[model samples]
Target: MTNSTPLLEINDLSLSFTSYAQGLRQISTQVLKNLSLKLHAGEVFTIVGSSGSGKSLLAETILDILPKNAHVTGSIKLDGAPATCAALRKMRGRELLYVPQGVTNLDPLMKVGHQVCLRPEQKQYQEAAFKRLELSDAVTKLYPFELSGGMARRTLVSTALLGTPRIVIADEPTPGMTLDQARETLQLFRDMADKGAGVIVITHDLTLALEISDTIGVFYDGTIIEQAQKSQFTGLGEQLKQPFTRALWCALPQNEFSTPKHTGAAGHATSSASTASQPESKRAEANSQVIAGNEPENAHDAAATQASEHTGGAGDATSSASPASQPESAPAKDAAQHAAQHASVLEAKNVSFCYPGSKHCVLENINLEVHEGEIVGLFGGSGHGKSTLARVLAGQLPIKQGSITFDGQALNPHSCSPVQLIFQHPELALNPRWRMKRTLQEAWDVPQSLLDKAGIRDEWKERYPFELSGGELQRFCVVRALAPTTKILLCDEISTMLDAITQAHIWHLLLDHAKEHSMGMLVISHSEALLNRICTRVISIDALNNHANCIEDQ
Candidate 1:
């Protein structure tokens, strides 16, 4: 447990996937770059990054679970001995455990009880673990589909601890759970670490995870850009060593977002004016009063009145930033004023939907409208139907109760779908077999400049989904959704998997394009700060559903 002998040590780990592109041409896509970390007993080591930053890949590599085509070059030592695949086999379940990000890990046809119990003798331990996680006896008899998302996550957590592993790697284990459920699930990991077990958790953000983590690793584009104590993420992120780490900390809903003055040599946010010309710079500095004064008398007219009355308090909170990061307050007001004159482009009137077998409806009698040149924020937590409503509006899901119209025409997924949708999980949205170039070409003949604007490299065009990182693949998806035919854009947590700098650039491109074409967008995200910064009006999905519970707490 001491520095002299750590429980797990990963040194200079680099991973690449060998694949055939186009014809029989061989290509290797390097994913991890010189990744190294040490996990000692009794510490909750948390890794936070944008999607596809190789956080999950690191966990998979440590567990020796990478696919056959994966070529890894690194030294992983378990208890100071070289950890090869054979060594991982000896340590996987007995000494080490893994909690996956998705709940589909459970076999659909298998009973929850059998899935948690690794062996016949482990049934008793599995039952005890379930009880500790607050799973009832009846849950054991049910299938995964019968369980809620929170319940399924708890089941996965219990499965990982069946053998009481000394080292645990939990990859993005808190998604789809309510705030309290996520906190409780992470607390269980913290408890495990407190009892002298080495625990690792990969997370999207540190808003809740920070409270339990002892140390934090900030990852950016396949590398650990910075490592710091949990307490170092304070004020304006001055204690943080890496610019990307500071940018991530600052971009949180709780922190003030200063425009990136420049990107550092490592691609981290610094004083980079490189992306300053992006439309996001203006949107990011837009009048906070646009959505901060609470829901207006009429959500559509809110931006108009607020822009008319917005004064000079926008820069006060972000005073700690450098002069270059600040934008003139006049441009934001002008942009909002111009947006106020646009006509309605999309509408969801008295719409409601529910999963086929669910007892309660996720959305009920929801009425909303998006005006031309407007960015409406659909703010809500998991289980509140933010995603479902997005799918329905985008015509991905059927409209059963009411209607969703774009440009006064019915939305049809099979057709041109003026309502283009960029999904929450880019991995599922993109085709695995298609190369990046082909994926982009499916919708529009996207230009290289457009791809570059989305932070994509030209070389990535030849690589398949498996060869690219999650964030990289997502960049392709974003560019595709911005097709010329798209009218009402449905951005379902589009930037969730991207780093702060890349996120800024993409938003800059989207907002800029939206302004030029007078396009309306429905932005669904859990980050209230982001919604506040970019949206003309932010409305709660739960409020739309007539649920009066805590929206942020889910």
Candidate 2:
């Protein structure tokens, strides 16, 4: 802990949105619960949690950028003074600065240089920041639409870092960059903290965050359930007190690869101490299947048993298929024999693609195959054409050089698509005007079973895209893509925005459903660890793109 006073302090801050449903009925849904934290000068404080755990919402609330209908409560103090909406207006871009998640935050018409040079004198510092981030000087002359996804992300980050603010809040800042680049970018935040500025980073990559964050706060169900030193998350998570925290630690592919299950209720720490002694009946209590909204006979008891595997171990990140718990196994889902015998369901033969107007092709000579019951991981650095390949395979974009075949036939554009693509941003994929149920219904006739499997609540049907959390909306996206007609699931960085617990739950649900349905999948991601943990055989897209720039797993 540093001796410096907190530059930003949040005490029991809660936020909710007010909206009207149907014709004229008013509805208010609470999205954030009593969340509190303090960011001291010269410290990097990171908030870790699931997709809908209010991490981004927390940032929006702090910056006072939440939707107009959003209602906020509790005290928010900045520089030891009340940080009400009025006070925040004065500090929005000067004392307090925000770095949004994507380039969409960039003004489309504004020149990049103009965007970064909020103050004329800051241009030199901005250029320095851009160089540190490995950005080109020419990039400053382009418009928002002119830059690639990776370039846009770097611009957003550079724009934020150009300002010398007292406080910085960056949300999911490393999604589109390579591991080394992400590490370097985060180190800049740490350096800013070293210079007596407060930094708060919201991201899904806890492994990298551990290297820089001074303290970590675990957010779940719209609140912070646990907070601890960054040093506590090490060596099987023994020093960590929260069960979920330990579960997150173990869920990393480098760890035990087990994700602990939870009842989805707020409160309670996952204790190996309590679980080391629980009987089979108690452990059964742990597997009560909260993803389907089934609470155990004893909620607390379930938490202990479910998270107990981490008592002296790791990687219990929702360990549902382990023989120790779920003894029954499906023969067709077994990877050893089933995957070998299952017929090839989807194949891309020398597939290559380029954007409609661009002269250069992003992907070339990409040959990939997936059989029924096979989960293929496609991993690489951002801008390496992973997502472009997914688009081609899913028939969203036409292949320029090669052919894609599914179920021994060419894809039909008019009929129901055999390949379903789940994008990284669920909200963008969904219709802001339509309700969740309607969007899901367009893909499947009876979506109830799919909803239950994907852990989407019934109440979410009435909610619009903006009303739901990214994780919740993502659940809907998964259900829509895994419809009966889908032969191949193209998941393009789908869970990159989610937290560890939600990431595990989503993966568990997906793996279970895919195995049962014999649905083949191509999982596109930047995190090699995530692919290593969930995929049967991870393949590098670099093998297809023929690019010599990115590092990958074979």
Candidate 3:
């Protein structure tokens, strides 16, 4: 029973913001340029693209939530009639619903149950929504800050379920969820579309998009470059029209995992007709060689060789030096020997942690170690204390039992910590009032080289956190954590919000810098494929905690 006419339509929609330059001069930056799309009843349409490509902006525009300085020129139609901002506002809760990407969308002071239900009559619907999303009834009584990332995400989804709406817009809703949870969430949207609601999903995860979408729109440079049926994204993306679309498909972790060969004027992937026409086997072979050839022999050995070449075998030693501070002039053999004899850069010896009033211990007797120049992957299901362990290691949370140490010494809370954490939600971690430049430089004076590598532009420095997209803000967070004094990094799903190419680029730069400085990293993620590619060895949270059966199994 699909509708013949469109349920929602946008015609030649554009959006820009007015900002000030250096000397009281105003400039307009257009974020969405003539973007247009249609949503039909009983169809799930997905928009996939790199981060900062205006996907979220489209969602905001439809909801009539754009800021005061935003200039919008567009026509939004519902049921074949023009939909104004006032009309959108009036119909927002009853006829339109949204599942935002940021968990910060939840009001901080209000209880979760109150926010989800909103009215006394919605209590039953709220309970049902929470149960379907696997949230505990007790969660309703808690505040936003009291819940874990996955719990917070589920809470947001519950709000959308409390009403019957004609259109549902979900923006990047699956990052903090486990694979099964993410699949279930997407399936819920698919079911909604089956019930004659127009569903619009925005994400950078191609695998998930392919599974749930009826039509896929490739968004790039503030416009839809290509639109195709889900069936068209088959083996090698041969049927896809746009080169950037094919490039995005090939860049998945399970696929070629390679960047595009050519770029357009905006530095994005451009069409290479000749390359696209090549046989699939040849392309696969080339990609395999590229991946295999890039593996370093030994991270520390490479670091030692580079240091020796630069410093010419000079040795400098101090009494307080840690393992990562092995003399710059040390030869590869000596560097290896020193690493073998030294303690791990960060260690948790029989560590256990519990929340202030919770009866259950989230983490118990967790023995973990991250050595210098090692990338340790932590894999677990959602709400399994993976993030809690990262916070504990980074000293954001204190352990109730056992000991945590850095280079065989206790962490000093007074001074700046050598271990820094990069959170999954960059928006929550950053200051909304501060400009990007101030936020990036809050910890240290980051170098221009790092900014360039992270793709941070000078113009972006003038924007606040809300003005920039999630992926753009994440780049700043990554660069901020790479200060010279940092010895270890705790990355919790850091690349989940990025597109395939940007994800690969950031990882490449991060891996190189970690090897060069002999910095250890504890990478926490739910993607087994990603962990297999980047980690020295992946450890399960259940195994690390010595549990036979975990909460996820139940």
Candidate 4:
């Protein structure tokens, strides 16, 4: 049923960006190198890779939306003919639909319904799309900022599904969605492929990709290292050809969940084989010690054990027990250890919140607490009050009633907040006009060591938020939140955009820092596997709020 000739094809495609160096000298960095792929009608092709691997950039290149400074050397063909910028522009919305990664792509000034419908004639189609996605009719009137991360993602999908397109490129489209919602979205993509449309999904969630992708391209560094049928990704990934691809398969939480030592600079999988062949006992020990989330003991007790190991005895500032290769200064270590003895608490007591002009309370009587040295996971269904609560706790939104306190005091709005919020959409959280360096410096004078630990490169500092991939921009956001003054960290789907390796790496870095500095964290995400791996304990938003009751009554 699939077409013999590809619907979209790329030949020897390469992309690079031009940026300034220390002086006025300009340098070009090739982020995407010799990438090539084909999408056939009636098939779903997925590109899986690490963060900053240029998967999203390929979509931008196809849409001809890359910035002016970008230099591209590639031939993009559609229906066996060249796809020039003008031709692509002509067919952009109707023939070549795109579901972008950033929810910021939605116009902040417009209502959701207007953005999706565009014209009065499209209202019916928009309604149908919303219904199919399980979005309430009321959501149509809300602005982009009013919607939760999951709702915003579904809205973007609705926009793409409104038109009959020859090709659909969705970039990390299902991150904030619930499991059912994510599966439904993928099923929609499959249905589109069955209807003779070529669908390309770029994602970090390999488990979801395996469920729907017909063909999978393993992306690394900048290019496609290997291409294999979905069936080939099997036990131990023996049927897979490339080491990195095999590593990715084995790294899934359902699989071995083994972390590779390192993915080499040249896109080689040097340590994947060893990781896949790790002994069961050794792997279990590593997982238990690193994540510390699966222990049957009390969550706080488990955290205490991890802290003791990470800090090498309580109140021992001179102890060389840090998990990071680069240790903190002696005075900083002394202060952190002293603070650990009397941990601060971030608490919300009988809190309630409702969006302005809305009759229903999104969060009602929500009581939650995160203690220093604790990583608490918050789980909830899409469009629920999870993000709303996070906003209130971070002081981004004022609570309608009750109180939120840190260390037994009210949050001060006049000065720099002790709490920092890392948003789900990195693009929206950042300034599009400023370079990456200025963005980080805007919060604090972030050390070079912290940037390196977060996988940010020096060359990237010169680029703007729009120039970097979503995952790459996310690193800057994470680093910005880790300022010295920050006490409580609120993460809203922070790792959803990253690959398995990068996700683990970031979590590992954060866990180490939090445990060492006695900082409390509230991590909000849809990945239960991730929560079980990193969090001390997972709590459902329904358990802490009356929003579910309000919905049932409705």
Candidate achieving the largest TM-score:
3
Q: If both were scored by lDDT, which would come out higher, candidate 1 or candidate 4?
A: 4
Candidate 2 lDDT over residue span 1-554, tens digit each: 45656788899889988888778899888888888888898889988876666788898988888878989999888878888778889888887889887545788889888888878889788989888987777777777755545566777888667667889999888876767788988998999889878999998889999999988888877898898987788798999887777877776555654445444542112222221121232332333232123554566633333222212111222443432244433542244343344455688888777666655677777788776666676766655677667778888888887888887788899999878899866766888899887897788875565555456677888878877776678778887887777767889878767666656656766766666566777887766665545554456666567842221110
CA lDDT scores, all candidates in order: 0.70, 0.70, 0.76, 0.77
Q: Runs in model 3 with CA error above 4 Å?
A: 1-3, 261-338, 546-554
Greater-lDDT candidate between 3 and 4? 4
Root-mean-square deviation of each candidate, in angstroms? Answer: 5.9, 9.8, 8.0, 6.4
Give the number of the best model, judged by lDDT. 4
TM agreement with the true structure for every prediction: 0.79, 0.81, 0.85, 0.84
Alpha-carbon deviation at 454 in model 1, angstroms: 0.7
Which stretches in model 1 have alpha-carbon errors above 4 Å? 1-4, 20-29, 49-51, 102-158, 161-163, 176-178, 220-225, 256-342, 357-360, 412-414, 547-554
Superposition TM-score, candidate 2 onto the true structure: 0.81
Alpha carbon deviation, residue 63, candidate 4 (Å): 2.3
lDDT of 1 by residue, 1-554 (tens): 45568889889989998878567899887879999999998989999876566888888899988899999997999888998778889887788989986555789999888888858999888888877776777788878765655567788888776766799999877654545666877898998899889999988757777889988988876878787887898898898888767877775544544435564332323322222322333334342333343544444544444442222212222234322244447776676555454454688898877666555566778898876666777765554577778778877776558888876778665677777888766766878799877888888888766765565766778777766655677788888888878777888877755655566656666766675566778887756566755665567776688843221122
In model 1, state the lDDT of residue 9.
89
lDDT of 4: 0.77
Error of 3 at 302 (Å): 22
Taking the tens digit of each residue's C-alpha lDDT, what string does model 4 give over 5-124? Answer: 788999999999877768778888898888888899988999998777888888999999988889999899998899987899999999999999888889999988889999887888
Tens-digit per-residue lDDT, 384-451, candidate 3: 78888888998889888999899898989888888889998899999899998888778799988777
